[model samples]
Target: MFITSENATPVFKDLTLVMPAVAVGNVGQLAVDLLISTFNLPRVGYLHTDCLIPMAGNNPYATGKDDAGELHTAAEVYTAPELKLAVLQIRAPVVKSKSRRFRQLLLSWIKASGFSRTLVLSSSHAYQRDDQQLQGTPLRYLVTPSLLKTSGDAFKELGWREMEKRAPLCPERLDTGAEEERLYVPGGGITKGLYMDSCTEDVPLAVLLVFCSEGDNVPDAMALVSHLDDWLHLLDNPNREGKWKIPTSWNLLFGSGIPPAIF
Candidate 1:
């Protein structure tokens, strides 16, 4: 269930919710880290459920040494009240059997909270891309029908490319028109599921993702965030190439130091 902090303030209505799908290269999560750290958004609450593997760690967005050790849960919510933005950062993968339950819970909370819209950052395996998909930029976007009317112009202005629906895998299914073109997100964990759910529910949802392989994906994350900034104007700078501050938590991403024995 979704739970708020004891001192959490009421600020859910009409907010734009952003989250990341744990996909190939973890580009989405890293982009979220950049956003939370750069904006210094506060941790407002967390979602407690059996659907996800339980996890806890030091606050990744801690501003200084005093709060460096603050405990953070697997899925935490942070917000920027002024911008009407809320970000849900999930650090752990969902339990395979409970994936559906988790999606239901998330969608229910979003509906109950009355968010204006939702955006998901995700990534897919680069090797799976078609020849046409590999021709240009690796970034692509998808928007539910409910959100198309509102953000369509902005997307066009930014010269963004919408993800193309792929043909079915089975050759026989194509003859009967039983195979409609559908968004296929290979390696995108819960992204396709969540998006399909949103489409069915008529929720205003948009997905921004990149195609990448498994490796150091900090650059891919940066590019994804930069693409978002271009459309949303999330940062203060007018220049599209403005630099974002990296979070302090990244210092320990690979671990704090070498083991004493090894040293």
Candidate 2:
């Protein structure tokens, strides 16, 4: 099941961006909304979408008819000339039957608008653990920091927000803070990791920053958004060591237009 809705657009300086909540989770939309709201940037567009699928291994939505009768909703388009950035949210349940169709729709919009690069905000678990391997080994978190960098008239700030916060969640230790620790477990213990079940603002910011900067150096990109996440993870935890290879400076190339200050 997939769904979409609309939110009001904003106004940011000369740059008006369209933020879309494509799937259920609106992290992408939330990130852009925060950026625009915080910086008072222009917003050209806002769209929201969602999805639903049979998870009990049986299509209860299906009647006595087509078992393959999956819900593939229609695609939507948000257009604007001043559109500098677009945020897309992909959730657990998309109209698999319409995945290709929706992808085509999104691609068509990007191509028609002459966007340099599409800043894809992919969910962390989607890359590491699909439906087939949901309860398998813990995923190794990684990212291409190279696709992030920007400065000058318009800049990109990249990073993830602390989605899961420490709260009085457990009833067993309602009054005892000693027994309750800030654990990163989303679903029991299998899906445990800093970003295993959560999406970060950094994902979108990194991609957008890169596209905005015309592919600048990765370190410079890291410098922009790296601090956004800060040191949320502590040592001795599985998150203390992720397999994401931080791109070296040699692996990145800066455009001549990039400021010397960034170097």
Candidate 3:
């Protein structure tokens, strides 16, 4: 459920939503962080749902002491009205049993809010990639049919490779010659399910994901957000390099000083 700040409801009609899928290396989340920090979009509401693991902290994007003490929860909503953009940043993993419920909740709100389109940023395990997936760029995309009808031309011009469908491993099913191929996004938490649901429900949605390992995924996040900018043109970097400000909270990524005595 969306609870607006100070009990003030904001209109999201026709806004384009970009959300993160809590998956491998949290690349999607990190990329959303970059977008939020870069744009300095103001927080509008909170997604108070049981679908995610609960967590809280001081404002991660706080620009100074004045805003530094603001309380932040696991899931929050930010919007840049001028850009017609809204972003949902998920800072925690989903509860294992409620994955389906979570997707339904999101779709219900999105449809109710009247977003023009939705984009999910996510990542999958690099090691799971088949031979064809290993070559070229690690980026992949999937668009629901509803989005295809409207954004079809834009996709064609982008020259992007669509996510591949692979046959299942079960021999019995294979022997039956089931002609259907499945969209498998291993390590992409709720990404495949959400896309499938959107397709079934006739929602205009697109997913952009990267293949990456679990180490420090800052670079992977960089690449993913760069691809996003290619489509949305959200950032104003003229040189196509530098200028993205890293958030203040990331300074302590690996925890504390490690006690100088231990060193």
Candidate 4:
């Protein structure tokens, strides 16, 4: 259920919704954090559901101790009305058994809200790339037919790479020769399933993803968001990396310094 922070539900019709996939390195989540901080978007509502683990904390985007005490939940929606953009920042991982339910919940909300399009920021394991994946840019994308109908020439103009489908290895059927290729995005939690589901549901959705590993992914987040800006034009001259603001919550991303006593 979506509960508004204000008394009235905000109108989201035709707004671009950007969300993250809890995948490898948490890159998508990190990128979303950047988007929220950069835009200084305000909290619109909460996507409260049991499909994700319950977690709560002080404001992750707080600038000081005074403002840090505000309560923030596992999943929240932020909005920048001027830009006609809405962002869903999910801080918790999905409950493995309820993954499908979570996806359904999201689709239902998107439909109800009447969003023009939805874009997911996600990442896959770079090391798992097949021979075909290793030859080009680490960034890739996937678009549902509904999005393609309206997004004609946009992706093509950007020179974006579509995620490659890999043929499964089946030695037993080597004589027959397997011709079917499958979308395999290892470490991309719910990304593949959600994308396929959106296709079937006729949802206008796009996924912008990167091939990355599980380690300091700040750079990966920056790169992903920058690419997204190219199409969305979230800010004037947003192509510059230095222009993006880093959130105060990211200060201790790796935790505190080592204790001198250990020496």
Candidate 5:
């Protein structure tokens, strides 16, 4: 599971799982381990965009939306179009800005490869499931629930008052800096930088595996897809006023269809 520089290449027999950071390498090291060790999946390819180009190491964290690095070349050997499916672990909405270009290129390659079944894996916001409200009203702190949950401590370590752990006995949720005026202290705790967090973990893997079974029970796959889409839509729309709800057409997009070939 600890795929160090020594033994980084291995051929998978059935399916190929692709994620953006898995290409740059270090960023999704843990995730790659989970996919390979936990699920026994193989590394087929990766995406390396411009942001990832500069910091490109053997396998660095994903800083861009479209850099395939060695994966582009490895595609033919590792990612065969005839494979059963391709699992793309990209939590949508969170990467909406960068994902557009990334997805475009991925879809293009898929079309070229002629692969029919593709699963776009994503996780919902943790806040949506936990029902946790934003500690303060700040435009910058507005993030998906999954991001917050996955990145539990990074936010606090960054010294953002909004994420600071208040006194356990008398917890006071700090507002986005604008609310700091309420506390007459200067520099009490405020550091600034891009705050990125990913908290959700349940939905996608489960959904993906249901299909990975790849059995004749197509109805089971159909049901799981329906369940997943329903959850995602509910998280996408958080209504503070009314009871949260998923859209009616959650299953319209999924079924037994083959994945888009990205080989």
Candidate 6:
């Protein structure tokens, strides 16, 4: 269930919610990290449930050594009121059997909060793409009908590629009149399921994802954030002339230090 800190339950009405899928290369989560770090969003609350694998760690957005001891949960919420943006940074994978339940809880919260729209950042395996998907940029986007009506023009203006739809399986069957095109996201963890659920539930949602493989994906995260910056103008200087502030918590990303034995 979603729980807000006593003093952090600021109104989220009409705000945009951004979250990441624990997908291939963890690109989405890393990109979310960049946003949190760059904006220094403050923690608002966390989702408490058995759906996600239990995990905890030092706060990844802490600004000083004194704050380094703060513990962060697997699924935490952060907000930037100035931008009217709320982000859910998920650090662990959902338990397979409880995935559906988690999605339901999430949708419920989204509805109750009255967010105007939501964007999910995710990634898929590059090798799974068809020939056509390989012809252009690796980045792709998907928007529900409602969201398309509102933000479609902006996407077109940005020259963003819309994810391709595939013909439904068992095309041989003719009773259905015609084979409907379906969105397929192989290796995207909960991405496809969540997006489809949002569409069916009439939630105005957009999915922005990149095609990538396992291994070093920091570059992919950077590219994904840049793509988002084009749409949201999160960066003050769009020309890359300005510097972004990195969160001090990132200092412990690999670890505090190497072992003396290794040295």
- Per-residue C-alpha lDDT of model 3 across residues 39-114, encoded as one tens digit per residue: 8889999999999999999999988999999999999999988889999999999999999999999999999999
TM-score of each: 0.92, 0.30, 0.94, 0.95, 0.28, 0.90
* Cα lDDT tens digits for candidate 2, 64-98: 35642433222222333333433332223446565
Residue 158 alpha-carbon offset, candidate 3, angstroms = 1.4
Give residue 164's lDDT in candidate 1 (0 to 100).
83
Candidate lDDT (C-alpha), each: 0.89, 0.30, 0.92, 0.93, 0.28, 0.87
TM-score of 5: 0.28
Q: Identify the runs in model 2 with alpha carbons over 4 angstroms from their true place.
A: 1-26, 43-94, 126-263
Poorest lDDT segment (10 consecutive residues) of candidate 6: 237-246
Q: What value does the lDDT take at residue 132 in candidate 5?
A: 24
Candidate number with the higher TM-score (1 or 3): 3
lDDT minimum window of 10 residues, candidate 4: 234-243
* Tens-digit lDDT track of model 1 for 1-263: 77888575557899999999988998999999998988878888888998989898887877789998999999989998887899999999999998888888999998998999999999999999987798799999999999998988888888989898887777565766746776799999999999999999999999999999998889999999988888778886453245688998888766788789986
lDDT of 5 at 242: 23
lDDT score, candidate 3: 0.92
What ranges in model 5 sit over 4 Å off?
A: 1-32, 38-48, 51-98, 129-263
C-alpha displacement of 101 in model 1, angstroms?
1.4
Considering TM-score, which of the candidate structures 1 and 6 is the better prediction for this target?
1
lDDT pick, better of 2 and 5? 2
TM-score of 6: 0.90
Residue-level lDDT for 138 in candidate 1: 95
TM-score of 4: 0.95
Q: Sort by TM-score, best first.
A: 4, 3, 1, 6, 2, 5
Better of 3 and 4 by lDDT: 4
Provide the lDDT at 226 for model 3. 88
